[model samples]
Target chain A: MTAPDPSPAHPVTGLDDVVHQRVRLGILTITHEARRVEFGYLRTQLQLTAGNLSQHVTVLETAGLVEVEKGYEGKRGRTWITLTAAGDQALAEEIGRLKQLIARVETTSTPEER
Target chain B: MTTDSVPAGADPRRLLSDVRALAHRVRLDQRLTWVALLVLAVATFVAIPFDYVGMDVRCVNGGSECQFSRDGVLYYWPAALLIAYTAIAFCYVRAARARGLGARVLPYALTGAALAVVFTTVWLLARVYLADPPTEPFPGWVMVLDRLVAPAGTIGVALLVLARLERNVALLVFTLGYLAVVLVPIDFGWTIHSSVRAEFIPQQVINGVVLLLGAAGFAIARRRQR
Candidate 1:
């Protein structure tokens, strides 16, 4: 008998490593639907410290996936983040890969087993 | 357990489920276009019942001195659409929050307020023109234009919001399609003694068309999303 493939039954070769990070994935998904997201709001939602969120945001910014704007909202300084076109495309691709994963698993397993 | 690494015990199904859940949240929020169309449907239905434009019959200068009896704009449709849009805008703000997006409500509120102001201004101008004896005799087109202005202005606000905020092509198309319905004749030139049944029926038909269109847009969007 032929040996079975040791690799995962559902391979997601197109998965974006930049977006696959849990927190960064969260950030991209949130900003994809919003016009712009405040830095503070992203931190709160992701439950990350300011330093941690800023680091991830910097990585995204460097990749040209997100834009960061610093300005004053009234008297207080505020930072806003939004996905660039590339970021939007990346998120779409990530979700497409995820959907493929789900579809593959669904088809491979019986309903009762699933 | 670290930020970069998946848990050692994590099954692929479990990991995939978590990712799926997050994507589902974003997808649900992205469906705000359908919510906007639903708002239009509700607004049209609510506005349909109040289609008749009631005129202020009170004389202004002296007894029987008023040039027109039904001059002031009732603005039933505009009010309905405005209310629905405002409500939907709030829903959008909340949905964004739920999906980990930060959005301010002030802009949405301002959009609705501006629309109300525009509709009100058009109605007031039509009323003033009707009240004046000098301008009322000619330019029947002015009355028709004024009547068209309310819904046009309402849809204009909708279009602006859709363009800047929603950015949904199908919703934009439906809003534009609604303009054809608004173009149906409104008899603002009718005298105080004229019957409103003629005015009422066409408006009801227009409202029906709007409701159907809005409902269809919502359904198609929902289906495509599925």
Candidate 2:
């Protein structure tokens, strides 16, 4: 009989490819907190150029993580973004994995590093 | 297509910290509350002249004596409250649109208006059934009820609802402070002994001052956050 490897799996393995990127994760988090955030607001908050934010948002939109609605507030066109249920769950899971990763790092550090 | 995996080079601790900081900034950008509080404070002050000038005296004991009361507030308060609620809603809508953020303010405004109407109806009914030209003081409980239904108390209750809608701890704290001022019996001792009349100033003035202070505090905090 052979014994399987006893080492724990890395928390990074649980991170979602669609959500792990820093900018996309920020978009998810802001939309989640604000419920429905405007595209301009997200761009400003993330400090990303319009094109950069649009690209990231497009990626998230295609992944079904966020929904974008384009409408006019008075005479100006505005776009609003909202997180989907799956997106919310993904964010929660990502945060949980990040916490596990942080804890793992702390515990594995040597006594002098502590 | 999915985005790339968490950048292998990125630090998880810094990423989490950034997410938390962004959330905190969003939470602090409560742009509409100060406007709402300021409108309510102004409404409270606007009622003073009506209260001071609109006096009603009813003769008792076959016209040998009379009782005085401020009847104008009874008429003015309800309408003023409705207008204030509407203005609050309008300010929230405009600010949300301008800032490109969505806030659940309609419910707060509607709840405030509904509460004002309910309190007004209760006060009117109480006057009709229990205390119209009463020969004696109202019971202790009735007095307490009177305080709760007053304009200042109604505003306090409404602001509590606003605090919940905005998810603002500071606003909640301010609401409690305002409610304490309204609920606790504190006399400012403003008495005018004039030939026109002698009476203690209305307590709504104190409530108004508290609301103004809350508005100023929120404004300052908001500027600092910005």
Instruction: Judge the docking of candidate 2 as incorrect, acceptable, medium or high.
Output: acceptable
Task: Give the clashing pairs for model 1.
Answer: B55-B70
Candidate 1: C-alpha lDDT: 0.62
All candidates: TM-score = 0.51, 0.81
Error at B220, model 2, angstroms: 3.1
- After superposing all C-alphas onto the true structure, candidate 1 shows an RMSD in angstroms of 11.1
| Over 4 Å off, model 1 | A1-33, A36-114, B1-28, B51-82, B102-109, B133-144, B184-194
Error of 2 at B121 (Å): 2.6
Give lDDT: candidate 1, residue B6: 38
Residue B123, model 1: Cα distance from true site in angstroms: 1.7
Put down candidate 2 lDDT per residue, B114-222, tens digits, no spaces: 8789878887786678654678877877776677888778888888888887778889998887887777645456545442222524566788888899888888878
Candidate 2: tens digits of C-alpha lDDT, residues A1-114? 999988878898888877888899899988887778999898888887888889999999999999999989679898999999989998999889888989989898989887
